[model samples]
Target chain A: MAKFSGVWATFEYLDEMSHAVEKIREKGKKPTVLSPCPRHEIDHALGEPQTRLPFISLFAGMLGCLTGYSFTAWTASDWVLPVSGKPIVAIPPFTIIGFELTILFTALFTLAGMVLLGVIDTLRHPLPPAVKKYTRFQRDRFGVVVDCDPAQTQDFEEIFKSYGAEEVHIENN
Target chain B: MSGTTFTYGKINDDMLRMLERPHPSYFLLLLGFLTALGLGVLSLAVQVNVGIGYSGINHPIAWGVYITNFVFWIGIGHAGTLISAVFYLTRAPWRTAIYRAAEAMTVFAVMTAGLFPLLHTGRPWLAYWLIPYPNQRMLWVNFKSPLAWDVFAVSTYMTVSILFFMIGLIPDIAILRDEAIRKGQKLRAMIFTPLSLFWRGTNYQWMHYMRAYLIYAAIATPLVFSVHSIVSWDFAMSSIPGWHTTIFAPYFVAGAIFSGLAMVMTVLIPVRVVFGLEDYITDHVVQSVCRVIIFTSIIVGYAYATEFFIGWYSGSPFEKAIFYFRPFGLMEEWTLTGEQSIGFPQIAFFLMVFCNVIAPIPLWRWKIRNNLVAVWIICGLINVGMWFERFNIVGSSLQREFLPAAWGSYWPTVVEFGITVGSFGFFFTLFSLFVKALPPMAIMELKEAAHPPMKKEAHG
Candidate 1:
């Protein structure tokens, strides 16, 4: 089945949570921190690299531009209702189509990328039940959930408390 | 959030409270708009059942009030994107409190605007013919046409706007979802869970989510300019004297932002008062918006002067005649012949000039612009003016074309008037429901902008 054993700590203050995060990482554990809002401090402490979402946006945008230009050009040429000396497939007007589609595709694909990547990440690490119970973590509290053995639960709890955690739940599944 | 201090929990509670059952007056207000919407629906049904002739549109004046309304609403939608996307890219702090409502306005305004073209067509069923899909006839929509371009631009603008708006809402909805779970509201929680996309505020989600938001904003920023520019081209591409001007794109865009900011202020002022959110939607934001309004107003005024200059300077009698007819319709001839007669186009022209150019000039004064009541009135005037501005451009130009024999005047029929009122009702009704249904402010973004709760030791 699924494992729910971990140490879930909540801090009222951002600094205290960042301190707890640093201590947990020093102890050779990667702690999953949650907050009501994303913090630059927490991000800096976690030291994760930038996401690849921009690449996806760029790729989608280029695809949209190419498709937009080609589709318009091809359609106009195929259905030759020759206007008064205007070019069969004009560049200036077609550019408008390309420009609009670029934005549309870029926006749609970027959102898709965020959702897909987030789903993959969620699958890799299901949320601990104890962490889920503290709904206040999405409101006023900042949380750090780290997995450890049943024996080390006490040690982790003390470390959390030492860093001034408002509450700590030790789960031994 | 700049001058105000709010704890994360307080922010959540304050915003959620807006979604709670409002005062009795709120329902009455909703009822009034719903009634107006009903009237609009009746009118539209009548028009559809009878014919488009119920509207005051004929040859030379076929693009009457409906096209004017289409341009006006589309213009109104631009400021929302500007506030949400452009302000976001620039990292303007004032946008935090105001952008959510503005985004909602954009979506709803576009919704209201989309109805006009369908209503104008008299056969909304065949509106799908505007699309470029292949059919049995092997016929495709003309790619060279600006109307075809409008079909793509508007739909794309609407889609991008909704997505950008929704993406911004996800984190806030997640908070609301968690709140529901905490309160034991199972149904509310279940509803919000999917709407939130099961957001958990994990670092992984934030990382990707933040980057995606930036990318969307970046893409949407240019879109803000292009969509309205494309709309302006709908008229500019035509050979109409007043409509065919190089300055129309920028001129329309500036007016769009001007009128849009006025609208945002118009709605936000009352909303902030009603919800007791003055601290969040502060005076500073209003002043910033007023400054933008002043800047755009000047550009709009400049465009007006430029148009007159171009009319006279181009040495084209057609352009000159249309310009002269706009402000002083039949005045030159009427005065020469000693006849006292004035046209409706003259009234529209003066109203446009007064509302768009002269009315906002008071905002240049810090004392006047700072007064919310004053700001609201100016915005209301600008809205009236902007509509007339469109009318003057579309109606006056078409009213007196190249051939005096082809000259005719157009006034909106009662049915056309009902439909116009209905579009407003539709917009306001959607906005009323939106504020109660969703967080009118960007809760997470507000929290991000605020100083986080920190330990005394951490402060050092």
Candidate 2:
């Protein structure tokens, strides 16, 4: 892994944080933004790609519906036991199980997708030095950590300060 | 929005402090519940050893307090999903503060409810027979049976609710991890880190997280409605007089939401006081919840009247006899040997009316709805009324059948009563532990609701 040095800046306001992200991106640096809550404006500014979770859940739910219905029908037919004189492959009642499993599988797959696509993204990228240095980003403060050469640290700090950053920390690792 | 004075930092700190600092009273209350839970476990062990006969269920009333408790708890499970999923989809901002605990209640109530069928089955060891997996003997579960439907419904409901609850917890757990690292609590940080899944609040992660949460919420809404409806069908599918009504599905769903909301209040009232969460879970939330209670109570009241009307309108002598016996209990002239002229069923009918319908009428007034004590008392009463409502529906109808010779009444044995109390103990113990372990509020969602990001404003 190529070790990149970075400077992280904390801003009290979302606007200031977004302005700082725009500035760093203008300099051809990828800035990692840490926020207390999700912001639509920040996502637009960062140009974050849309996730595939919805499509994944849709396919998973359909499979679940199939699995649920077929499981009941196949098992009943395998046994060849008629219940209360009803047909072995009862579709109407089996639909309830199918419906429940559809939701269950959809939810399970969505969580799995979230872990695979969302959380893993964070794990794949190194933790921002700022997150380790200043804990406020997890609570109230909005922050941006920009990866850069050690020689460019001062320039990034100045860009951050001009955008109303309350504090700046440089980490070279 | 008018009442929200919290900043993101303040909300995070307030919730985190509760998890970090345990109150003396919390342990005291938990100890009381744990002791009750221990007694309940002892009762269950005795019942298992002695056989299902140790319960109040007898020949005619094969489904007694155990089934009643099952339906009651499952019904209570409904409100949590209603608040968390249904309200979330409807964009009800007030739910942001209360939904976490409500979701927890749903998951726990379902767990508690899931136990009853196995407990009622005499041969609980054969509970796996309920599953329809392929086997060597080629025995499959009865797909047409409502009891089998319940296994699928309750299990799926539990599965979906737990997933929804855990997904919602991730962001808050990440916040806890960050706080733990800051506070030098290495052990807590180590525990929270992996659970948080390395959430860094990046927009990419939020994008996926938001969409997944919306999908879960969408599915959970219908799942909650279905679980309770299936529970009601367990009675309605039968040919027995009171259980044969077609209105059972909607009636049970409404009653379940009503009771579940009441349980949320019963639990949250004490929780807010103990945790000092008055700011987040305010009187507005209480009033909003009470309004829902009143609406459902009316539906429940209508169902009650409609059930009697249907019984009369159907003109079946058996239906009329059961309805009449429910309230008036076989007039003295027609009393059979071993049958009381008027019994506990009669008393249960009136009590159900008073608690489920008549008692909540006071909630229409702002004074009663907003008053914490009054809200708590009424919710407690509704919880009681709903349980009796299930009891009356299950026990009374079973006690009298088409053949008068087969009719018999049921009164729960000591073991059955102990187990019922113990289920409550188990529920509260899980809830009490949850409050202490995790952030009871959705800290991130609350901040989003309270102070949403401005659309047009930009940096100067």
lDDT of 1 by residue, B1-460 (tens): 4534678888877788889988999999999999999999999999899988878898878898888899999999989999998999998889999999999999999989998888788799889999999889778888789999999999999999999899999999988888899899999999999999989898888999999988888888889898889999999999989889999999999999998999999899999989888788888899999999999999999999999999999999999999988887785543534664566678788999999899999999999988999999999999999999998988888888889999887778999899999999999999999999999999898888777898864453
Model 2 TM: 0.94
Instruction: Please give, for residues B1-460, the per-residue lDDT of candidate 2 as tens digits.
Output: 4435567777787888788768687789899999989888999999999999878788978898899999999999999999998999999888988999999999999999989999999889989888876688878788778989898888889888888898899889989888889989899889988998777787667888899888988999888889888988998888999899889999999999999999999999998987788888888898899999999999999999998898899989988888888878767724546555447687789899999999999999999987999999999999999999999998899888988889887788899888998999999999999998998889888877656433346433
RMSD of each: 2.0, 2.7
Each model's DockQ? 0.81, 0.61
Q: How many pairs of residues collide in model 2?
A: 0
TM-score of every candidate: 0.97, 0.94
Superposition TM-score, candidate 1 onto the true structure: 0.97
TM-score of chain B of each: 0.97, 0.96
- Tens digits of per-residue lDDT, candidate 2, A1-173, equal 44647788778887777877888888888777878888766876776657888999999999999998998888777778755687778899989989988988898888888878865566555655446656676688887877777999999999999988888888898
